[model samples]
Target: MATEQPRSSGSNTQRPLTSALAQHTQKKQWKDLSTPEKVVTATKTTTNYAVIATGAVLVAAIGYAIVSELFGSNSDTRIFGDALEKVRNNDQLQEIIGTPMMGHGEASSSKRRRNRRIHSQVVLDAEGKEHLLMRFYVEGPDNEGIAHLEMVKDQRNKWEYKYLFVDIPGGVRRAQRIFVEYNKDAGLPAIDDK
Candidate 1:
């Protein structure tokens, strides 16, 4: 007859070497760590924060650039606003097109196209000067017309109008073109700087 041996319970078994190493390397709370371990942990935390802060700053810069380019004083939207103001204030234009004028971009059948983008381009001439050419539409109670504008950068780096005109189509009378500004000496054409 063989003598029966007692079996040890699973809880009394020794953990494997890999499991023991994993437990040894597991991250402890800040207060439980030795001074050297705390230093390494702090360094990793600071690096992670720095990386997150850098990404946030990059996103902010991109957002600012987009907003400034869309709404800044030198932007196409600002140019359209200035041109619309001129059309509204002109006595001849008011007489022909009527008061309470409305200005917009291209004509569209979509009534929700309120924020339509104005057509514009920037070009460089033979004199190495910059020019902004743009087009928009103007409407009134009785008439509607197309407004074309060209602006050049002056010596002070400010935009000055080279030419601005409005063309009104006619049914009973001949088509009329009105010039709000016409600088004959600028001698700059709308050359595409492709």
Candidate 2:
């Protein structure tokens, strides 16, 4: 008999059940999220930083390559310039100057007509070798074309001409012709055209 004991207001079973329902609700909401949405959100934040870093590295590499190429020891200008300096201080030009000169090809004729004046200067080194600097002035040409030729003593103590700018028309060839003619008078072999 009697009435059952009144249930206690503080009940562990009820509390646990309520907390469990709340946890279940939170877990279901979290689990229902789309996979693609999560992935895209995460990628969007990380990819931007990754792309910017990659671009910066690529730009730096390209810049370094260009600068290294320009200033490298094996650069064409460095080697050619050094060879030209040696030619300037040699003693071969004096011996070659007195010899007969050959005419440049048909092109020279037309160029000569266009260029009304041909101005040339010669500077001698301590060894008596001559460095020739010539400029051609054309009546209608906007800019003058200049040629620099340096004659130096080779290992055989003979004179040889080295051209400063190889791209110029007849620059190296003319120097070779002059060297050959002068060396021929001295009973030496003609300069090879290699």
Candidate 3:
């Protein structure tokens, strides 16, 4: 009988296949690692931590910007809210526009008024005062009108009303204006002035 040869020892005959990017690496104890390998491992760990930290900071910045835009004291949305509150609570406005008044941006055909953008602007005057100007629409069961408002910041950085009024245009009758707050000496003539 011929002598049988073992087939299990095939490392020399069959070489393990690998690609440049996916070469197999064996795990080694820290003490067994070379100086270059240890440095590469540390660098990779630092890079991963750096990427995570950068992502966290970016997310936090975006969150802060959104919050400030919607809820900050000087934000347009906040000013719109304050003006709408004054309009809704005014007894004269309720009498003119009828009860259950609603405020919105420019007139639109769509019934969804919540998404409308309130038209507003902020400027610095020659007197070194900040001015906020805004215009919006108000509607009620009986009528509709356009509201204009101007506010100036006081020495304490608080908003003080310069003028707030509504104009109602009529079809069969003449137009009308209802003043909620007006400061005649602040560059604009009084209503009764010629």
The Cα local distance difference test for each model comes to 0.86, 0.42, 0.85
How does residue 135 of candidate 1 score in lDDT? Answer: 91
lDDT of 2: 0.42
> Which of 1 and 3 is the better model by lDDT?
1
Clashing residue pairs in candidate 3 are none
TM-score of each: 0.71, 0.30, 0.74
Winning candidate number (TM-score): 3
What's the TM for model 1?
A: 0.71
lDDT of 2 by residue, 33-100 (tens): 68986777668879999999999999999998887656654333333344434333334422332122
lDDT of model 1, residue 76: 83
Q: Cα miss at 194, model 2 (Å)?
A: 32
Which 10 consecutive residues of model 1 have the lowest summed lDDT?
185-194
Predicted structure with the largest lDDT when compared to the true one: 1
lDDT of 3 by residue, 1-194 (tens): 99997686757676676776566565678888899989998899999999999999999999999999999998888988888888888888898788798888877788865688889888999977788899999999988899999988765576778999999888755688989888755543346654
- Candidate 1 global CA lDDT score: 0.86
State candidate 2's TM-score.
0.30
Between prediction 1 and prediction 2, the one with superior lDDT is 1
Candidate 1: tens digits of C-alpha lDDT, residues 51-146: 999999999999998998878988887778888998899888898899899999888999787987688999998878999999999999878899
Decide which is better by lDDT, 2 or 3: 3
